[model samples]
Structures are given as C-alpha cells and as structure tokens.
Target: MLILQSVAGLLILPSLAWAISEDRKKARPRIAAVGVVSQLVVALMLEG
Candidate 1:
C-alpha cells in the first residue's frame, strides 16, 4: 500500500506541475483520470 501510494504521488506530482503551469479548467479531466487510475492501482494492490 505504501509503495502504491508513493508511486501514485510521484505520478501526480508532474501532472500537478503541468496543471499549475497551464489553465486548470482544461486539465481537470486529465488530473481526474490520473487520480482514478492511481486509486484503482492501490485498490488492486490491497486486494491482491
């Protein structure tokens, strides 16, 4: 779980930087998708 969270955080960090640099409204969906996938990964890891 910790590893999965760490990986997700690392992935999110770049997207967050990009989102901050550009218009957030346009990047919302992309960010959300990343979040969703990260959550799914964490869930799968925990279940397995």
Candidate 2:
C-alpha cells in the first residue's frame, strides 16, 4: 500500500503542478509528460 501510494504520488504530482501552474504557456504538456516519465524511470531504477 505504501509503495502504491508512492507511485501514485510520483505520477500525479507533476500533472497537478502543470495543471495549477500560473504560466500555462511555459508549462507545456509535453514537458510535463517527460518529467513524469523520467521520474518514474528513476524511481524504478532506485527500487532495483
């Protein structure tokens, strides 16, 4: 359950940051997606 929560947070936080950002023009969806993917990859690598 803890691990699941951690993963969910990793996925959701970046999206939430982008969603609530004041500068929508600067926070492109592609950048946010890339950040999320990179974070997930790093997390998985650390877990191993």
Candidate 3:
C-alpha cells in the first residue's frame, strides 16, 4: 500500500508539470497542482 502511494506521487508530478506546460488555461495548472499535493498528502499519511 505504501509503495503504491509512492508510485502514485511520482506519476502525478510529471503529469502536473505536463499540464502546466501544455495548457494555457489559468485554472488547469492550479487543478493539477492540487491533485499532486493531494497525492503527496495521502502518501505521507499512509507512511506515517
């Protein structure tokens, strides 16, 4: 479970970067970042 959460965090970072770079829309990047942060938080919670 912990390993899966870590992998999810790793996957989300690149996707967030890609979304921020490719999309010109203002709200998309914010949404992507929020997703990334949410993943990180979940991962940390699981680890803790």
* Best prediction by TM-score: 2
* Candidate 1 residue-wise lDDT at 33: 71
Candidate 2 residue lDDT tens string, 1-48: 998998789778877887888987787778777877888799789989
lDDT by residue (tens digit), candidate 1, 1-48: 997887778678767776677575565667667876887788789989
lDDT scores of the candidates, listed in order: 0.73, 0.82, 0.72
Decoy 1 TM-score against native: 0.44
**Greater-TM-score candidate between 1 and 3:** 3
- lDDT of model 3, residue 30: 68
- List the candidates' TM-scores in order: 0.44, 0.65, 0.49
RMSD to the hidden true structure, all candidates: 4.7, 1.9, 5.0
Candidate 1, which segments miss by more than 4 Å at Cα?
1-27
lDDT tens digits, residue span 1-48, model 3:
977876776787666667777545545666766877787798689879
TM-score of 3: 0.49
CA lDDT for candidate 1: 0.73
